[model samples]
Target: MTQDATAVAAAKVAGVVRELTARVMQYDATRDRRAVFAYTYFRLTSDLAANLRTNTLSFREPEWVADLSVTLAAAYSTAMDAIDSWLGLGAARPDGAPGGEVRAADMPESIPKPWRDVYAASTVRHSYVLEEVLFSMMAHMSYDLPLALRALDPAAHGDLRRHIADFHRMNDLLASSVDGVQDEISARYCRRLHSLDRLFTRDDELFTSYGIRVARGMAWFNCHRLLDPDAAAEAQGSISRSTAAFIAEFRSPDDWKRRHAFRVLRALVPSRRQWPPAGTPPA
Candidate 1:
């Protein structure tokens, strides 16, 4: 696509992102732990989508991979809708609605139960920003993403490949944003220990690499599985188990080593005592 066409294509996608971002910011994710993640994802996806749309960020092939942008944005938008419904911010629809253009006609039918399971567990803000981000990634990449890819024509394997690249690119974007995201999380949920942000950075490279690899694996596996349902069924347990393990790690309050380290750090720092302090109150 030409430059003007490319901009035009991304324009619609950008507009949708603006709308979703507003919804995300408007919702008070402060009271509920789940809302923290809801807000995190909404903000993350909104930024990424807006970037991709304007060509401020470049994926493998912007013109050819435009669908990837729209589809992924739609997936995030749908999840946001799910959050709103679950939290009663908007009208709930037990049956999912594929909220954006370029989404599967039967997205509700294609979405797996695991997606809902993770969202449901977000009721308490036990997980750190990183863990919450991972949980959201698991649901979207493992469950929602495959269905989105599967909805594409099998012959369009080339398109699928580009989308996979776009997926990892977004993962890289997540890696880049970890510090900012953690700041947001700390501001909202970890007000007592925002100064210890360094605790979460030790495993940053490993975490980003692992997340990108897993997203690629899930996308490929799902695309192939769509071509062969019986084979996918045979291997379903393995897929479910792998995804379950990732989710299990984040779902538990005690899963993050950084949190433990922060506790130890807090003990060593004298001034850190008196959380919420005398004059400043917790948000």
Candidate 2:
């Protein structure tokens, strides 16, 4: 097929896949949902960033891929930071009150370091590949919950589309901004894109050939908005144990080792003094 025809076909297939993805979400019996909503928010943001990255350039350009990688890295970093900040706050406020903080000991015991590492290292300086992988996992969860809500409720689906589209339309351009001074970064990005496009596009094509794209469209409708924040939290809390189990039982060592940035200073800082002996705030 010609390039233009191919693009159109790809888009159409993606849309069908999105709809199907929404459909599959209807079957999630396990209530744990935080990761799902998180994925929806993160990817919707990623999609928005991707659009901005490619707004002026055609995908055929080698430069287009580089610009996108730089863009993805930066966007993912900022998004990850935002998520961490929020999660930090949530852990600190279990009773909905302030003052108490997220204790390190409170961290889930079985949590995979890779998952947490992905969380810790998610910075805009990196590309979207990691973000894509992380979100893909969440997308699996999203596929089951809010998506089902959309199918059963038109208002739910309509609201979701509108919200996601709006967020995607407006967000900070960290990657582009970072490239403002580093002129050669785009060149590096393009080279990486050439390699990655082959991988992602290949998977996309295989899914398409198998008629799966008509069901799980990567760049299509993205209708996960039917899930509200409350639902997501309740779902997350419910699944913490199961998620913990999956991490310990299924994660590979490669996954854990692939993501740590050497923190030269993090370990050097003085430790907190035993929480000041319970209630003694004495000087």
Candidate 3:
């Protein structure tokens, strides 16, 4: 399917993700706010640009693309809130102010478990940069996008096939972009020393960590499932339970091998302050 020329024409904007990334990076440079999340956003935007370039740009319908693009940008905005807070530049919790907060704050309740769980995990813990990026993607794509779609049009969608295509196509693009994203992340945050390939991708199914491919597929399934009037409640409950269970593991110290490894890696690297009060904040 050729991309909807009309969507781009009407909005007077293209490459929304690309543009947002650029602006975020420029902010980072200007303020020298090299917060860890900044690099995560960089990977996200770069991967999104790759997705648009190679897979869905020409095929996705403009409306869907616009929705997904805006959804992503909104998620990025919320993330920036956290980043800015960490830099002492601003205060915005992932589940706080910002329109996306409505969708996020209601997670695992009004929305799916993945979104709620991922956000909770990230916020509650001091995680690896990879966890920050991946969990944010998990929550935004898996929850917010679908929830936003339902809100935009509550009518039962007849375009399941198209939705699935777009969803899977984006996933594929992310899978392909993983290596490159990992490279950029490692270079900047991981001391430009250790490679995170094995820790992240692991060469399992679809070239990602074990079960993530299936998890992503499930996220796609849940999107359609959430739109079903009858099934929506049950789906939300199931997602909530599963997400809660996964999050519970983090609460226990025994289940911290992954977190421990990341800590060791980060500690091995020399201390590098990302941001240290650079004059007055930008106006």
Candidate 4:
């Protein structure tokens, strides 16, 4: 892509990030559990957009990365827009229908399954914040990512190996974002996450970072499968099955022990005395 084209792509990412930030703020004001994931996503995308603007990572194919980011962001925004329309949240409908309303009966078939699950879980007050974040991550990384990669068609770009390298380079940003993301989650939702982080030996970070790395690796592998004529259907089916299984584990009643432990920790840790002002930029 030409320099002008890269600039255009970067500008598109910035616009999407701004829109997402507004959505996140709306969710927070409503005390919606969806805010947990929305905030995390806002931070990640903001960081990516900032990097793209500054050429901070010096990505080999910066335009491709910017375009991929925009693609994934669009998918997420589309799903959210559908859900918002269904729930009467006042967002403009994607279909341009009057009053931004979607019929309840049409909602289930309209939204992607993983996102459907995420929205359902968000309505449950007892759902774990971390699990909600993971649900969003899994939906985007495991389900949306391969499709984005396939759509971009790296082979058609240039230097396939360089594209792959740039992809793995994202893991570094993910790893670095872990602590700040956890801090934001704690500030916004659960005060006791710090204690739990200690109880888990900071393995929470290890688990999250490692899980994201593995998920991205699988996404890359699945992208290859998606590009293959014989394997695309099977690969997509496998993605759906695995994502469903992940959501199921988080929803199971058998996880009471962990929930009980969290309750205990909540009792032990003092609540945050002060929250960052609304619209404060994430660290």
Candidate 5:
């Protein structure tokens, strides 16, 4: 799709996800936070993916690019933690589990007042499972960029043709995991996501370890989120640089940070200071 077309599609998908999220949050507010978090998380990441894809300018457009990237990256980090908290993962919980005082029975109290209680229960967990598949599709894309890039002949100098062909196969698999994605998500991408999910589902521990790295890195990123633009620049510069030094067991030197997107695909872990903050939830 053209950049403009891509932006429009992303906006539409985001709106649908948000609307779906609000409805689900009202029914089982407790378990549904996971869906809400994933909804927003995918929105932000999709936004960034769009932004990153619109590299229509020079990297020297550092002022424009860095400012936006830092802010959006911070937003992505926040949404990620929110997702983990909803899932009962990360520093948001005791021992980093998302489980809390809220239980399945406690859902009604956790429900948002803005939504209709009647419609809420109907779509609770199933909606979340649907999002899990969509986000899984997204995570697959965001994470595999590096490896797919490596498979390129390297003659194209980061040209995306080969990468898209290979990575998109995974994208299709992820899309297929969602129930209606065949109608909405591309049929090709949906089929690919389903296939890839099957391949990776059995490798839970490896994925979890990778997720831990991403969460920790994001926590480090979020601690710096409230900083002003210049500071954000310096901070992201440090991160981009650190990502430079952050060797991956997988990735060639030339594409190290670019490939590190897999690590960044997971939720951001919280810094020690952000935990509980004295009166919030107990650790």
Candidate 6:
């Protein structure tokens, strides 16, 4: 695609992301746990969109990147839409009434299993916000990302190395967004997150960034496996099983112990002054 074409595609994708962000913010207001991930996703996509518009990163294949963004965002949007429809919250309902009884078996096959797990967990009152967000991240990054890459077929565009380089460049963007995203989550969902952050200090950001780096690195490896004709079938199953297992681990009882430890540690530490002061809140 030409530069002009890429610009148009990027703009369209940005519009889609903007709409999804609005929907997710509304969900957040309703105390929907899924918003944990959705809000974080919006933050990351907003940063990506800004970079795309300003050509800040000078990505080797901006067009391919833009297309992948659309694919990945569309997958999330589609999964959320399916869940909404199943739950009778779809916009298509004229009276704002339930869409009527629907069984899980009736859900569209296009909505992947990882996303199903995400929506299911969102209904649990005891689910931690951090775990919800991580589950959503795993679904998007670990499960959907490699498939999105395969769908785009990077080799058809040009040199595969250029595509890989652009992919790694995204790691820097993810790392930079961690602190801001954590702040948003703290303010909107869990205020105690501030105390937790003070306990860990900069190590909090470092750990989150490291996790993003590792997950994305695995995604790229999976992308290569998906592209391999002989490995494709096994790769598909592995992606689903591995993502589900990762999410299961997050739901384990041991996580409760870890969370309890953080709470105890936070209580033992002195509280630090929060940013923007008491009178001036985040806009």
Instruction: Give per-model TM-scores.
Output: 0.61, 0.24, 0.59, 0.76, 0.22, 0.75
Quote the positional error of residue 76 for candidate 5 in Å: 22
Give the 10-residue window scoring lowest on summed lDDT in candidate 3.
95-104
lDDT of 4 by residue, 43-70 (tens): 8877777777766666777777778888
lDDT of each: 0.51, 0.31, 0.49, 0.68, 0.32, 0.66
Give per-residue CA lDDT, model 2, range 91-145, as digits (tens).
4322222433333234443433223333322221222332233333432322322
Identify the runs in model 6 with alpha carbons over 4 angstroms from their true place: 1-6, 89-110, 154-159, 194-207, 253-283
> Least accurate stretch of 10 residues (summed lDDT) in model 4?
94-103
Each prediction's Cα RMSD?
9.0, 17.1, 7.3, 6.1, 20.9, 6.8
Question: In terms of TM-score, which candidate is strongest?
Answer: 4
Tens digit of per-residue lDDT, candidate 5, span 163-275: 33323332332233334322222231133334434433432222233443443334333333313344545543443333212222222224565445423432232111111
Poorly placed runs, candidate 5 (over 4 Å): 1-3, 27-203, 206-283
- Which of the two candidates, 4 or 6, achieves a greater TM-score against the reference? 4
How far out, in Å, is residue 134 in model 1?
2.5
Descending-TM-score candidate ranking: 4, 6, 1, 3, 2, 5
RMSD of 2: 17.1
Q: Write the candidate numbers in order of decreasing lDDT.
A: 4, 6, 1, 3, 5, 2
lDDT of 6 by residue, 1-283 (tens): 4678658756965885777667666564554456657767877887888787766777767777778888888777888877767556352221122343233244556568777666555444334555566667888888888877777874633245557878878888778788788888677667776655454443332238888898888888888888888888999998877755765554442458665765565356433212222222122
Return the TM-score for candidate 1, rounded to 2 decimals: 0.61
Q: Show model 1 residue runs off by greater than 4 Å.
A: 29-32, 53-60, 79-111, 124-130, 154-159, 162-171, 192-210, 234-243, 249-283
User: What are the runs in model 4 whose C-alpha is more than 4 Å off?
Assistant: 1-9, 89-107, 154-162, 196-207, 251-283
Clashes of each: 2, 15, 0, 0, 16, 0
In angstroms, the error of model 3 at 160 is 3.0
